[model samples]
Target: MGPPKPSITISQQAFDEMVKENIDDLGMDPTEALQDAIETLTLQGVDLSGIVTCKEDPVIQSLDRLKQLNSNWTDRIGKDGDEVMDLLDKLTELCSAEGSGNAAIGTRNGGIELVCSVCSKLRGGSDQGLVSGLKTLASLLHDVQSGDTFQRSGGPKMVMAILSDISQSSNILNGGFSVVAAAATGNEIVKESFMELKIDELMLQILRTHGEGSIHSLYDAIRILLTPDDNRVVASQVYGYARRFAKTGIAEVLVESLKEGLSSPSLVSATVTLKAVAVNDEICRSIAESGGVDAVLRCIDDSGEQGNQTVARVCCSLLSKLAGSDTNKSAIVQKGGMDRLIKLAARFSDDPSVLQEVMSIISILSLRSPDNAARAIEAGAGDLAIQAMQSFPGAHQMQRNACLMIRNLVARSPENRTLLLHNEIWGLMTTTNRIFTMFKQSTFFQELLI
Candidate 1:
């Protein structure tokens, strides 16, 4: 049956171990961990169909307590609130499922009743139940909201908890199609909920995953996050999540925009996403090896400083970050970032204000690693940076920056300072002086001597 549940199925013994891991991690009771693992694995369609079908497993056995406990919840909230919450904590810690992209849940009327009860009149004294009850309540709310009217709760904690449910596969509570449809219907409310939890990656996962029905709001959230007027304060939240959990579909969306050529400031989402995926070695190696590299490099060749300075900063940062590593670095250098930066500098060569930005990026990448700056020199970045000292017009911020970057190389090894000499590191001292009134003791100026 069911094509013989994958041989990798979690056996009873293994499930018990996970339960031992306590609610925090490896500390969960093995029995509980096993249950959580199974639930998560089950939702992801991990090979536990056999165990699920066995119908006699300990997890299913443990769930029997839930039915009995449901009736006791009213009493538990009154008499044993803390104990109940402890049980719920164990349940969430052990049974937590990750978002399965397609989170299938339903709107059972009884579940609705439970939803209403969280806000119902309080009991006498401290609620008898343990904090575990809150976890169970949260799980119920997340599942119910996935397909019920509780989708628009006014409370902030309630919303964060629902989004936090992503740590557990959204599949844990996929009861029926009605749940999915209901969730789709209240898309906007779900997005509004995220505005509060935007800084939480798990919450971002929920928004990006289940929040798809209200994708426009998701996009708008990004817009507000990166809006020029207020970007400095919260821009990191949007960029941070996009990098951490951008949807698979985004690649196609961005490629289309990049090909459309400056139609949409592709960097805001696309570049940020590429850099995000490029972070961890596992994700980076995969994308770095694929055609994704070419797409990102081309994005740089196409876009300008139109929307989201941070996005642009991340793009430059990605190229710079990948500098030392052979796999991604080679790809960046080969893709013409060096030459591209040269052209960017030349285009704004006469405009000091614009060149200030170009030079600042140069300073960042220069410090990324000596070899990257070396590559910049080989690509003629050295000359551009030097000439930029003059046309930069404002403070010799460029020269000062270059001198400081050269210092890092100097501190680690005198050879790094020697390497900068080839970039004509010494010649910029006068320019560095203009940029820094204190010339000799100034940050970059000191870098020049070393």
Candidate 2:
């Protein structure tokens, strides 16, 4: 009939009023309800990015302690004072414990330093814990591979100040494994329990911290926690931070900090954090899709110069997983990544290891996948890659990898395969199958002739 009348629907204002009334009847803040909903999503592994909030969590209660220390004198002394002093004493002893903390009373290259520093600072004037914490941390720094060692507690205990206190700290920024350089009495522990014991409590307490200076060791602990196995905390921590920051519908501040570290001139702990955070596929793809990859690709491309060497290495390692797909390959090429990689090879022509890494990336793209390989060739990586694989004599690892790339290019293209066959690829393989097999099973044992 006359294009049917529109169906009746409640008025927007009427509906809004009804919903608000319903929400009010529930005895809960809709804002908090929304937060609870998001946390639910996070628990289920959903992309709550841009929908969360890195709340302005006050630094831990220690701030009050610091202020109180400045306020009343005799108000907190004697047995109470002795308690503080003893804590300072025990922590100093524990912090100064060395050699991985295995032997009795031995110094450890662990979080004992962090505990010592914080407790020592708390002890103050007498500065028992401060001196011990600093000395232990410094010594541990010299021998320990990372900083997320655990002593007193897990993430929550270490980052207690970030959630509450931070005054005693001078500059507890992250360098590598989170550098907690105190003003001789502050900047302490907790990155991730990469120490003797794994922690299980107060994760929320630890993850809430998004402040600095206001806390003693947040930066240093975060840095340490982001190292390798320790880096495992990233997905949850960032997801929580993302969930918190996203509540504003603007992830700029959170993402900006993440981006700042990625783009920092110093390829230090921040850069390492970026890499760790990027490991979350959702976070990484979002970052790549959001143009973080462009910067990383730039670093990847500039890997030619010695000045950019560290950046290149970091880029290579960080971008490894991102480059595993055709779309990413295409994106990288469109973004000028291929050219830079080629240039890097040329600049470091003598450095076969660098060439090998670059070639491995190219190979990863071209592996038995014709279109991608052709795209790689079109990007001008083929000749240089081939030459690198062949130019290096001796160790067949590089040659084997090079052979595999060339072999893949051949397998993907009938013409390329024919040409390679014409070139006696069998002979090449016969020359080095053993070396190439270490790369990947699919690549090395593909039953080439069939």
Candidate 3:
């Protein structure tokens, strides 16, 4: 033999204990827990390449039992289907393994057949078996390799069919929606299937009546459906999607949900989704009228206190959009929104995007509502904008928004103009105006000189 094959040295007792800890303490599936334990040991410099494997007979037996139990005993498992899902998670892990080609071909094919069978069940009736099977399929798809294999086997279209099939019972719908969401994670093709089927509106309805323990799944589905992966960059705004989301009572649901003060992952998704749709004036008005302004303001304040930057960022964006409306701008001002935004601006001055949004909101307020503009001025909004423009001289949007807001403030009240001159923004304004005029130059000779 070349060199001795490396092997992991662990007592069977240690392996068992590790697996149990991962399952009970960490909430990992048993198979994953086992794999994690082995990997952890390897990372610690333990060799696992040459461990004497147990006989194949027992592993084959377990695989057989898992397939049978996932398909047949699903209905027999009690409501909520936790027990069945646990077994399926284990089965999913097994089917994706390769063991002398024995586990690879047979187990993988069996898993696909089982998913197809489960998808077929979703087409008609609803039962514990159907629900449990859908949950299992979701777990299987949670693995990237496994989901790809399933999709290649025509399971993606099947999943989409079930997602779009509104006739299914609520139980099946809940389970199916969740499965589709999990399967579609980072899978653009699956995402397209949901979009192509035009299930965005229907999914929103399901989200309104979302099941008890499936809030994440429902929210995930809605987020992915509303916000595609590619556009999740600097500008995640989609006007059409926002318009449609507003039509589906999304604003009302999100606003009302925040009112209850329930803390969940859904809040982040809701805020992000709201940001996407708040481009519409109707949605902005609805958000404020639905008390979303207050809710979002509180979220901004609370997220800052809790160091939840993501929620704070999106919540601020939502408020910025809401402030775009003339009526809502006054509402935000009366609610002390300017003070909060100013504080946030100071705290996050190092962040260009956040500063841009803050200045943009001030621009809108100063443009529409003189009273709010006065309040923003009182909050030192002029200085804040000037600082932001100075900090990011190359950011044309920030500079443009700042100059526009300063202009609006001065135009709104002679007092604000005096204040602007007092703060010494006159020089910055002159420089910015010249730069803007240079940017506006269209002639090649003028551009070359610059």
Candidate 4:
């Protein structure tokens, strides 16, 4: 625009050397040396347009750029839109760098307020900007301080507004849900804030409106809301949240979503959310009555056919949790859950983690029910457990879970003890006697042997 802005260029190495010279020769503070370098280059008519000035840490630099861009935001999308998106990208990268302490740095630099302001400004104007802002905000809120700031600054309300806007794109809604999930994780006050905003109701409405398209992030947020805090004192609040979610009809909606054919990611998230929501025996029974058991078994069958071990593993875990209820245990058996689980174990025989989940389910199902125990044995759970034990001799959890499943299978059913004994469990036990020594001192292993 003005005589081509007097263009000139320098290599990155050259720029670094210049900054080094300013610090080494001039004996200036690093920040002062950087500023001096920038000033000298600008006065010399050198274009340092694409250079990283190193004036501040990356988190602070990004926040400052975001603040500048927000001030210049206009109705018409142009260069400012591109700059806004770039800043968001840089902030997201900085905050997510593992062990960099950038998230904590960001919180100290008022990143929460700046990013939230950017999101609020970008609302309804730039979908790309709004999406990126939400993503950056999520990363910034990884720690407790950022989450606390977000809650105090009415972040939940802003995020809920973004999600409630029907005119927003699916990408925007997904990003907003991710922010909710991140903010609610391990932070009691933020969780309470989101609860007061009726985030659960909003989540159910979004699921109903968007169906499978938004299931992954929405269910992730739902799961975080229902999960207990790490502190044992607030653990009871999780049960309260679960009850609230159940009363909100989320259990029925979740079961319905499972009935619909979901992709692997969506199915995994749905099962995880269901697991978190089934916090008490009463809620577990409610979900079971809502056909949650059959729905989950169907998910296992579908995921197994697709060779998606992750979905199968999560579904098995949910089935195990639901089986805590006596009624759900029978329901799982009635729905052929044991057969499905045993087949899943066989299909994923190479994965000890999957086998552990399967064995855990069997342990619960056979806890006090001889029929279920017999069904488990009849469906080849004993064979599956023995095979898992033999294959994964070094897997402590797999071995422990197998031992528990065997104990439960025989605890109430004498016929199962005879059947399992004849199934060569004793031979397998002898083969694993050395490995079982790791647990020999434990009473559970002693019971398994007897």
> Considering every candidate listed, which one attains the maximal TM-score?
4
Candidates 2 and 4: which is better by TM-score? 4
lDDT of 1 by residue, 1-450 (tens): 333443454554554444445455666654565567767766866554223323343334434454455555664455545544454444444334555211122122233334324323222324323223333334444432442355443433443443344433333222211222233232434333444454335424444565332222333334333222321133334344334343433433434433443445434554454444444554555555555556555545553434333434445555554443456656666576667766655655665544455555555555546666666666765566567664553555555654454454454344545556766656654545554554565554455455
- Alpha-carbon lDDT, every model: 0.45, 0.45, 0.64, 0.80
Q: Which window of ten consecutive residues has the lowest lDDT sum in model 1?
A: 100-109
In TM-score terms, candidate 3 sits at 0.55
Give the per-residue lDDT digits (tens) of candidate 2, residues 193-303.
222122212222232343312222433343334333322233434344333223332222223333544354333433444554444445555656666566566555545
The list of candidate 2 runs beyond 4 A from truth reads 1-159, 162-170, 173-263, 305-307, 325-327, 367-369, 393-404, 419-426, 436-450
Clashes of 4: 0
Better of 1 and 2 by TM-score: 2
Which residue pairs collide in model 3, if any?
Answer: 7-47, 8-47
Model 1 off-target regions past 4 Å? 1-217, 220-269, 272-292, 303-326, 351-371, 393-400, 404-427, 430-450
Q: For residues 1-450, what per-residue lDDT tens digits would candidate 4 score against the true structure?
A: 333443687765788799999889989988888888889888988866335555556777777877776677666543248878888888898778887767766776678888888788888676787888999999888766578899888899999888877556788888998998899887878888888888878777777777754546888788887777545243446678888888888888887767774453366677788888888899899887787887888888877778888887888888889989888878788788888888888888999988899999999988888888889988998888877887888887888788878888887777777777887776776567654565457664445445
TM-scores across all candidates?
A: 0.41, 0.54, 0.55, 0.81
> What does candidate 4 score on TM?
0.81
lDDT of candidate model 3 versus the reference: 0.64
Candidate 3 C-alpha lDDT tens digits along 1-450: 464665546654565687789999999987788788878887887644223223344434544665575567443343444544455545545543544332333324355566566446434443665666676566555444455566677776676677665556666776777777766665555655655665667666666555322445566566655555532244433346557667877778777655544375467766766666677677789888888988988877776667666766777777777887878888888888889888877777777777777777777777846777788899989889778877888777777777667766666476777777777775665576655674444332232222
